[model samples]
Target: MESETKQSVYHSATYHAAGEAIMSFKPINEIHQHLCAFHVYSSDHSRHVEAHHYCKHLSKDFHQCVIYDSDDPNARLIGIEYIVSEKIFKSLPPEEKKFWHSHKYEVESGLLQLAPKSLVPGAATDIAEQPAMLELHQTYGKTIHTWAIDVYPDLPLGPPNLMMSYIGDGQGPPAEMVQARDAASGQDTAAKRELRKGYLSSYERVEAADEWAKTGRGVEFVVKEVPLKK
Candidate 1:
């Protein structure tokens, strides 16, 4: 009697209809474009995380990138980075603008890189030298890194950290870290630095999110005095 009841439910009209509905629905897979990889540091510049960006171009002036910890099969969702042109950036309110960071140093210094899995040796240098990247140089990104994979490698811990783009000279990830990445990916950052010299003029350095912390504008920083016990 139990077997018969189970068989009746499996053969029911509602079950068949549900299965048919699921089979008829097609997945939308064309909206995402796998763009590149970026090595990002926290706002305080204490930790570094490698992010792979899969972007969806919303319009000519804006793009939304979904950042992953890596492109491997076991990759984890790390964060999201939103890119906007200078026109859109300027349109934002003063308080809203404080959350975004400019891409000037990231582009000129060859810190923000394209995924090497999709490129051959020296190809990234050629791509960076193109006029297209110059547009990115003027853009701003607002990134929020949810997973603290760098500090807590075993698992994500604590609250989500607001990530910022590198703005100053030698402020990006360490040389050894970047060099090791380049070796595995077949990218030559040193050579790309040379090729990107002429394009430096196109980069317009803008105020970054980190600066907001200093002036107590957008996000307030509070200090607590703790007594030292001997």
Candidate 2:
């Protein structure tokens, strides 16, 4: 789904570096976490998209991420995801809650993880990553992918699709899908599944969120017709 840049003249890169030196990237500079996960379209569960989330904490209760199809330098910007704490999510109207999905299954299942797997189990990096993963387990996320890169490889087409996280056993992506990520990132989702059982054992799902898990259907957008101004 990714390819080397075929056309370039280095002019843009030169100006980009110049801007970096003269201008301060205040907001984006705060990006502190790199997370990688799989997102399936809410409207069609069959479409699985691998996402790399470069995120920042906007406030105590909220986080936002810019998603990319790959970690490569020229990775295409595919979507955006917003994560809100349970306190924030609990206040939303029932209809609004239908669009957000829980992070518990993704966290515990190891379908979601901080980027760069630990070379050694329980190393400093692993210790640092554990709490972040646990915190995410309690939050809810709403993701939308503007680029249908998996199908329309050359260009993004169609409306932005609301994305959802996996929640149940046997609902995860296929073996080959998992294999591709593990091969690239040195991760073991199966091992992570067993490792997290002890920490996440006491976790409980919130009834007001992840409406898709309760109802078999998901939220999506469709073209609507109306009279234009005359």
Candidate 3:
């Protein structure tokens, strides 16, 4: 029997229905300590429970609070996400700090493809005209990185705009793909895949949701304390 607790679902291509529960996290600071010990974050317990649930899925805790600081104190809780697990935090490579920037550009460009046929025909045409090398680098760079990681299970690579279009394609031709190509070429046979573990200490200015479009804090992130729900 289905448990009384409502289960959240994430969209995936492999399944006709929901894929899995969305992962979440919370802070590991005083507020979290208070809540676990006292069932409150210096604010109303009911309001922030949902937000807490969201982060709890990611196996972290909320630090300050976003719920109580809003103009309407009684509003359902929201908070700036801080304090991720060491596993996720370390995933942000010091050398690859610019990854998010490149990824942002790549994602934005891909989204443009969804516009009407008349929109930016020149841009699309340029992409279509670009040499095979440029297209491969731009399209499959992230996939290569993802695949190189042993910690993550294999992932599918297809149209960037649609991440869920295919699966079981993780083992394809190496000449046409970086991950497969690297594995096949055997240039770095001894190069062990990096283990991914760590939290994302970066702050995204807007309230984050499950959509891919919601990443990246527009400008330099200003530290802000998210209060608990009232």
What candidate 2 gets wrong by more than 4 Å, as runs, is 1-12, 117-124, 225-230
Best by lDDT: 2
Span of ten consecutive residues with least summed lDDT in model 3: 34-43
For model 1, the run of ten residues with the poorest summed lDDT = 24-33
lDDT of 2 by residue, 8-86 (tens): 4366678788999999888788998899899998977888898999999988789999999988988999999999999
Candidate 1 backbone collisions, by pair: none
Evaluation by TM-score, superior candidate among 1 and 3 = 1
Model 2: ten consecutive residues of lowest lDDT: 1-10
How well does each candidate superpose onto the true structure, as a TM-score?
Answer: 0.73, 0.88, 0.16
The superposed Cα distance between candidate 3 and the true structure at residue 41, in angstroms, equals 22
User: Which regions of candidate 3 deviate over 4 angstroms?
Assistant: 1-57, 60-66, 70-79, 95-230
Give one digit per residue, the lDDT tens place, for model 3 in 1-230. 24433232222333533333353332422232111000111111111111211112233311222221112324333233233322333455653322222211212222111111222433353343233213211221111111211122244232111011011122111223333322322322112111000111222321121122243222222346798899
The lDDT of each candidate is 0.69, 0.84, 0.23
lDDT of 1 by residue, 1-230 (tens): 99999889878968879888787433224335444445455445656777777776788789888788777867888888899998888888877877788877777777666655665558654664366466677888888877778787777776777777676676657778778777876777777667778655754555544465356333322355789889
Q: How far is 11's C-alpha from truth in model 2 (Å)?
A: 3.2
- In model 1, what is the error at residue 86, expressed in angstroms? 0.6
Candidate 2 versus truth, CA RMSD in Å, comes to: 4.1
